[model samples]
Target: MTTLRTLTACFLTFLLSLAAAVAGKPNIILVMSDDQGWGDVAFREHPVLKTPHLDKMAAESLVLEQAYASAPVCSPSRASILTGRTPNRSTCYRHGHSMHPKEETLPQILKKYGYATGHFGKWHLGTLYKNSPVNPTAAGYDEWISAPNFFDIDPTLSNKGVATQYKGDSSEITMRLALDFIKRQSAAKQPFFTTVWYGSPHDPHKALDRDKVGYEKLGQHKANFLGEITELDRTVGELRAALRELGIEKETIVWFCSDNGGLKNLGVTGGRAHKGTVYEGGLRVPSIIEWPGKVKAGISKLPTNGSDMLPTVLELAGIEHQPKHPLDGVSIAKTVLGQEKAQPHPLGFWHYDVAGIGCWGEREMQALLKLQQAGQEVTDPKQLRSSGKPVKVSTKANSYPGHSAWLDYPWKLHRIESKKGKVSWELYNLALDPMESKNLTSEKKAEFEALKQAHLNWLQSVQTSMKGADYE
Candidate 1:
């Protein structure tokens, strides 16, 4: 004899339980290393550099052999990863340029779904100190201890706009703080979305003596360079171990990648030329998505990049997200699960003519420290960047400068526009010439023309985006 009131109460209880379950989504940790090459890992047959822990992770997870960074440069790649759109759309056209205020970031979405979001280490997307409207918090992180650019030993970072000088290796300190945040979230029974971007193996390589022991056979600079990567590897191992100890490794998603390609001098790039170029060497990076038993193990030839991160993670969490603006990336969740193959969309890369805004890490940090010590709030407009405008590009119609590439898998096309406004084209069959040495524009006129047209159409869309047409 069930009463009507009892049935209603039961339905209400079920709704509450379902809401709680949705709130406890899987934890996601995205770790990115700066300047690490596609061949830097031991599994790639590197002559000396060894990454035992990363190799093990790759063995357990799906490896994207053809992974690309959204752009050949750092800031654009970072911006694309956060917003799942072309970086230039957000006004992050070059390094040191800040993201636009209107873009919806991954952390912002995750936080809305009851996740504790955090960002650690390099925050080169914008100025971290003083209230730049584009800082980590502005990007929707609940906690962040980040630097202006690629920082090194004993770096002074902004802890949510407060100047705090930390002691120890850069990656180590970043990981330690990230772990602390993870532990707190876990203790509170909250899911976390943490991003740890390490500043390692970047210019002016500084490595501790202990880490540089075996690399002396290489020149001092190369030794220090390799040593920094070695230390970065150790930090990665610790992060995995900590997840295991928490009994959440199987449920957590640990996505690892580098922002861009290796330096030309390093000779570690997998393709021709090096960083800052539109060639495979500059875009291709070592990427892995580890979810213990969830992600299928083995190599995936799918052409993916940082832009795919937001959509992929959201799909993995079973959260349906439709971006407010056009997305340059699509969800690769099926690919991760081994249910699908082949990239669903083509990736676009562009390097606009604007010069990168330079950021001096230590100097800026010291300046912030001085302001803090003087009991003055960060009111400097330059530090705040409220008036700092993006490089105006929409004013000129059909004025595409710098290099742009369209990677449509087997066939690739390049559109190079010199500062003098002279435009040229290069075509390569990547499946045949991975080095992109021999041009096939004249040989395969049909394929080249098709890609060239597609790329031109894409440029028009990108230009529209730059005009803020996509923002709702």
Candidate 2:
């Protein structure tokens, strides 16, 4: 009887511990749109486009009025979000750059805590082919349905490792796959972390007929663009409804944002410049987080960036693991949960412009697809051909050129250097000049000089990390 009692007690304890773990972990869904602008949503009062579903999400979410992507482009910003470091720190200097395999990613960190991780949709960080060092699976995803870059109608996506085609609007197709994954995980009573990256509203402007008819007056291109956004908005609605249906609505965190700035001349630029530029319009994106039970629905203007996402996820999930390197992002858990109103550090952004490893283009993708179709053996050529090596940045450069900015709330500073060694400084009080129309460097000499030094110090730190100092 004594032995039986001891075994029974042990079994009960194990069950309770498992229950506690499941109760504490939240289902995290991060949904990002490619090239969707800050002003693209109806809630932002865009003159033409309407996004009813996203507007509803904004109304219920903890919206960030001044959220920025770590970089002005897609791949670098995605790398920043995954690694909690700025693009320069990882040498993900521009679009199409693959993250170094050595870097620890968010999915890898969460996996230690028993989260079933999955990635769906666009994966520009690297190739989606099987065994690619930078593929979603290699980066720590347990399951993934993704494309090498932005994929469109009848998209060819790699499901785990096999390339398959899907019908319907790209946004809807991506969300359906994510929802299926979420549903399966929920049914199995497992916590999940899913990334749904939509390729819509990026280029070539192909939208569903049902979504485009309402915007016919805007011209074919504009109509298609806006229609794609509407499709994306619909997917957001479906995701929220699915979570509610799964009885986990209050226990999930739904975060939404654009990968980068809007395309130029579509009149959706949120600030001074568009897309590849480092201006406010290029970097600032519409962002929101809906954590039903924890975060109160509200708005905040505290400066935040893509690098902050990983740290924030770790903090919220109660996971503790030190990275092998430094992180640029500060956790915003307190702010999101209505406990704090400001961030601990200033946001820094830079465009190094120097290319890293070249992208896995159409040719490689075709070869992989043919192999999959033939039911033959498939392996990632890029990962097999190259060594998983750390990047080394030079420490003795006289000066770093290109655009780098230090954003400390209303005080924004820009350091622009030309290849000819001509350097210029520009400053703006964002409170007064949201458009960055006037340069305040001449007027605020003291502020300009101080911020310049701050920017330089930050640049040096990033450069040190790039040289693999953090790994030591």
Candidate 3:
């Protein structure tokens, strides 16, 4: 009887330990940079810019080589990250649109599990007005200090609903706010979700005087752009150090990535066409995730995108609230855990309807007005469209010639449709040509035809989603 009692005690102790481990949910910090390119990092072979901090993080984290932004611009990519749905489905295919409040955001989902959620820096999804249901607070963030758009140095941010001034480099200011939130959450022994979205390396590229001095020697605008990226990198390093000091480094999952591709006009190119274009250079960006005890260090060649983040985080937090709407992204928890060999999804999609100036152009504005004027009964006006079907508009072929691309397995196709209805297609075997230099549409007509149809099909699906259809 004594031996049996001792054995039972040991078993109970083991179960208790296991329960403690399971209850210790991790703190999540998602760090996003604005307009940063895939090749901006010093470790990525940019000759002049120095990003030692990011380089170090990459060395110590899971580096995703082919990570892409869901959209070629800011608002859409960010929406995808929050919703785990395609930008079109989220009604955020444009640069300055708002995400619907009815949809659950990553922070909101985590909040149900007792995570203190805070969002700092850029919050371009929507306005911060109390009437706007798409603001940070409406989306489930408990504390928010954010801007409606890209802000430079010494920016003004809306704290919850009030505007406040913050001095110092934009990146640093954002990081400071996040660090403060982290400290508070740590004191309470509560898990936290903080998103530090830096508005650097975008337009009017401004860096601290010291940061610009080293690049001034290069004597080019590209050098200035590089300086901004370096400054952003430094801020990231500072945040990571803070987490370590708080004894949370090993228990925190820190994800670093860009909102979209680089700006070519700034002389920083990713591969082809910059910024607004749909080329890989415009959509692909650098991404790294560091969870000291959980994610194994090394490079992951898997083709991941911004949409995958929400599902991954939900899984990590042990929250099983599947989104009410169909999600285009799959949880990459297996890949993060080193149990998967390849990406879980078969294909990724990208699409945009408003031409030239992006999805939020005059055309889209007019469309919104028309919807309002027609008294179209919308369950969620903030959503792209409650029906998931594209509003039928006369589409002129080749209306947006700047850049557009579709990637399916080994083949990638680019459709550059100009303003005059002239559509030109460029095809590249991504497995063979990552740079997308060769155009094989003429040589491989059949393959080109198949890919073209696929691209159109994707556009159709995007249109459907915009109408607010529940697309899986």
TM-score of each: 0.95, 0.92, 0.83
| Model 3 agreement with the true structure over 1-472: per-residue lDDT tens digits | 9999999999999877755644688899999999988888887887777889999999999998888888888988899999888776776657776676567688887877778899998887876544457778878899988877777777766677555567788888888899999999988887889999988887767777777767886665666677778789888889888888989898899999999888875635557777766777888899999999888898887777888999998887676786778777888888887887866353455555564222222233234345545765224444423232322333333243234567775788878755556777889987888778899999989998988887777666655655545644
Candidate 1: Cα lDDT at 220: 89
After superposition on all C-alphas, the RMSD of every candidate to the true structure, in Å, is: 3.3, 3.1, 8.2
lDDT of 3 at 299: 87
User: Model 1: per-residue lDDT, tens digit, 1-472?
Assistant: 4688899999999878756855747899999999888888888988888678888888888899999998888999899999998788787898888888788999999877778899999999878865788789989999999988998999999999899999999989989999999989888878889999998878779999988887899988998888898899899999999998989887799999999998888748869888888898998999999998788788988888888999999999988877788888888998888776665478888888888989888888888899889997777777688764666764367777889998888888899998888999998888899999888889999898889889988888888888877774
Candidate 2, 272: how far from true, in Å? Answer: 0.3
lDDT of each: 0.87, 0.83, 0.76
Once fitted onto the true fold, the runs of candidate 3 whose alpha carbons sit more than 4 angstroms away are 1-22, 265-267, 344-351, 355-404, 415-424, 445-454
Report backbone clashes per prediction.
0, 0, 13
Reference-based TM-score, model 3: 0.83
What value does the lDDT take at residue 340 in candidate 1? 66
Model 1 segments more than 4 A misplaced: 1-18, 21-24
Give me the overall lDDT of model 2. Answer: 0.83
Q: What is the TM-score ranking, best to worst?
A: 1, 2, 3
